[model samples]
Target: MGKKRLVSLLLAAVMLLMAACSVNMGEDEPKTTTDPGTKGTETKSGAQKVVFWHAMGGATTKVVDQLVDNFNKSQDKIQVEAVYQGTYDDLLSKLKASMGTSEGPTVVQMYEIGSRFMIDSKLITPMQNFIDQDKWDVGQLEPNISGYYTFDDKLYSMPFNTSNPILYYNKDLFKEAGLDPENPPKTFEELKTAADKISKTGKAVGANFAIYGWFMEQFFANQGAEYVNNGNGRDDLATESLVNSEAGVKVMTWWKDLIDSKAANNLGRKTDDSKKAFSAGQVAMILDSTAALKGLVDGTAGKFEVGTGFLPKPADAKEGGVIVGGASLWMMNNRPDEEQKAAWEFIKFLTSPEQQAFWHINTGYFPITTKAYEQDSVKENLKKFPQFQTAIDQLHNTKLNRATQGAVMGVFPEARQIVEGAIEEVLNNKKTPKAALDDAAKEITSKIQEYNRTVK
Candidate 1:
């Protein structure tokens, strides 16, 4: 059988098994009830110490520490200790090794995709109960953010440091190329033309991207294609994937071309390396998480300048919506109920509009709440960097479609590796775009089946 036929057949078998298998997240009734304004458990006089593990570094980390201090001083009941626990993968390893050992922190920052393993392990407690008991109404929060924490119909974590990808460029390079720095590319053909012009300048080598997987997702989502099935992404609320399709293949092929022409340098298999190259002005345009802007500007400091723009689209592409990235706060199990209460306080504090405004200013992240944007302090901060609106505009332009359901497969990082390898083949001229992605789809499907086998 051909690779396509074999993969389609494999998908059929897996779909059949999926139909036969049934897994329940939890019971039907809500687990905990609430009481208004009552202090149930009191460790009077001395505040409870809640240690939180996160991946933020430098300026971002400093701001979190200040928030912790602000929260501690605001109330007499909780004291939060925030720790810079290596990277996301690093925290995953630490979290796994320390399981049931009783030596780990009370709360940890987990990337959205990695939350599932912890959720399944029963290592992290559902936080809704605590919120409910505290008489908190979650309905008041942003709906888009709720999915990030809701797993199995319950809240397992708190959304923090959330960000979506956007296009970044060096304006100086654009001017040198004789292209309007203010007139950023709005469609695919224009993007191609602008890139070619910028590359000719030799001041910087054309456009490059840090997160190819994320770039593919935004490119397709903007076209109204689904990356995965379960509700636009692995929101932990959806039940399927959408990685194999015509639109998906098209998006992959697009990136494969960039890799092929060396238009964008290899992300070098390491995000830091690509980021360094961009900051050093080795690459003219890049698509990276907006969360990196503050650092990029900080690193470039007087050497060159940076500019922001929305992702360009193909002429036929539909509106776009990207799966959110960064990390969320998962409340770990094993801590006493009182400790969980303290942790709940920390979660609420981190997400408040006042703190959100402070954080957006300090770290250059988009505000999570509508109110944050309207704040006077936020208004003043907006002048220096009007590009903050770029993220909002990007989010607003998104339209719901099958293409927007961002793909979520188990062992996502591994699946990404398979995808990266497939693109490598295209870039290296080993095969045509169609053939490369067809083989990639087959390999991806096989891995999905393998992951499914381990699940049950």
Candidate 2:
């Protein structure tokens, strides 16, 4: 062979190797296409990929994972990836940072108070759009639960895990204090009386209500009081805070008086701490979400009998109901049409009667759909935990009103923090209840105004 022939053969071999490398690299890369709708990347299997960010932790996380796995395995057209994003606050913070970017989730499970902020962000495709497009029956869901997420006759999000506040008391302590074990306190005065009597028995503190801001909101609603103006921020955007109104004064006064009279103990702001105290029999009564029922029951098993009752109100306060407290699933508009539709499918699966029944029984959160009650599993679970009946009855007995509908404000998360700080101030004797609440209301109103300006 000649020298020129050898050099040409070597050059051709080098070129062929480079071409092979390029082809391999192309195959290894993800197959993604950018469209006008920001459609997500398709998997190698040709399935649409949907990312779901949720705040569910502990055992509930396992349930969520299992549900997602089931959905992924049930079909091959779409695949969902569930990611735990710490607390709801953490998730929202990350979401805010990821807005207008591909890093954000296709679906996010945000706490109920974040509804106004989510809507104002204009980043989400209102769940109502999908419902209307599909001609789905919205009536199948619990009206009370749906009412919270509905604004201007539109549903912005799908209610996933729904709950409300309830009073959990140790029936044995009531009996020991010479009070009726079966009849729990229904009014604030009665609660105070019971707390005083139970505390005097030396069994445990009469009550240990956590200094959580959510409790303050619920208390206001229980008194048929709106937390903000503009019809609880439902009729229109709320411009002011009503946290220092007459109803607010009554709640703060009664709460402070209870602690001052040694009828109840303030357990700081962490609800988990108070729940642990109750489970350890260190407190006779406590206020908590209905969602905690299962954990509380199991934690106190074989130790004491737990009795549940309605959230108490001022004796003279007209009959008002508790507000629904929980999170919802939001579909982001930044996702592609196919990905958004896939996320919607997952949302529907999560709210289905069977899935909702399982979720309710396992987590103690109310199934957003009323049809879940018809499931045998739900019925059996209710029979096993009769105390849960109070939650159901309370939800049904609640009249649909502005107070019960709950407040909506873009600054709700910040407002909650402010309210929590004011509560701590009052509890620590650093300020008068009126003074602290007034300051909090002012701060919250200012934040709301800022949010409004930014959105506009």
Best by TM-score: 2
Alpha-carbon local distance difference test for all models:
0.65, 0.82
The number of clashing residue pairs in model 1 is 14
Candidate 2, residue 357: Cα displacement in angstroms equals: 0.9
lDDT of 1 at 195: 77
Clashes of each: 14, 0
What TM-score would each prediction reach against the true structure? 0.80, 0.88
Rate residue 298 of model 1 by lDDT.
74
Off by over 4 Å in 1: 1-45, 134-140, 151-154, 201-203, 229-244, 258-267, 298-305, 400-405
Compose the digit string of candidate 2's lDDT tens values, residues 324-396.
9888999988899989998888888888899888889888889899899999999999999999999999999
Write one digit per residue (lDDT tens) for candidate 1, span 91-203: 56566556547777788887665555555445677777777787777765555555556654677777777777777788888889998988777766776678777776767
